[model samples]
Target: MAWLVSTPSRKDDTGDRLFLEVAAEAARNERIRAIYLDVRAQAFANISRAFAGLMGSDAVSDEHRALAQAFMLIELGSVCARTLLNEPVQPASDRLIECLVGMPV
Candidate 1:
């Protein structure tokens, strides 16, 4: 007797790009990327209070939250530093990188 197939194998699927994979997963699942962005924003808005709440819940891992908080502060410092220098960091791309990769003062 022949056995029945339960799950599809790689041969049965079409390849997807990185962006497509992320978009498709976000579309089909509840845990979309947008939700993470929103939660991360809220976490920063009230970090002292939210940190306590975040510690109590499991929606976001504690380590990830800590990293995000540190990154947020770095971004804030980059913006403030540029404003003070009067260098007029006109192009937004550089500012974005500074926010993401620059160190906090």
Candidate 2:
């Protein structure tokens, strides 16, 4: 089951903001980690969308590319956390990274 925490004060869609808030709170509860993992996976997907322009070899917006990197880092961190907890690696992790690498930055 997913835990719904109230949104913290923030002004960006960097994904790190949400992950940090979730991780900080989840650190106190093992049961909540799975929900955080799910959220992190979603964040990875959101970040992957930034490559839309780059896919066509068009100029990508700096904002989108930067946000994408932030999203990737967050996903990587979440993967490490899952590994530490002995949870199965999220299946989309490699695929998402592959997409990132395939896209033009």
The lDDT leader among the candidates is: 2
How would you encode candidate 2's per-residue C-alpha lDDT over 37-90 as one tens digit per residue? 787667655554545444553444665566466555645555444534534444
Q: Which stretches of candidate 2 lie over 4 Å from their true place?
A: 1-21, 57-105
Per TM-score, the best of the predicted structures is: 2
TM-scores for all candidates: the values are 0.30, 0.36
Q: After superposition, how far is residue 41 of candidate 1 from its true place, in Å?
A: 6.6
CA lDDT scores, all candidates in order: 0.42, 0.50
Candidate 1: tens digits of C-alpha lDDT, residues 35-87: 74575578565543433343454354455456456645544443443443433
* Whole-model lDDT, model 2: 0.50
In model 1, the Cα lDDT at residue 18 comes to 38
Collision count of model 1: 0
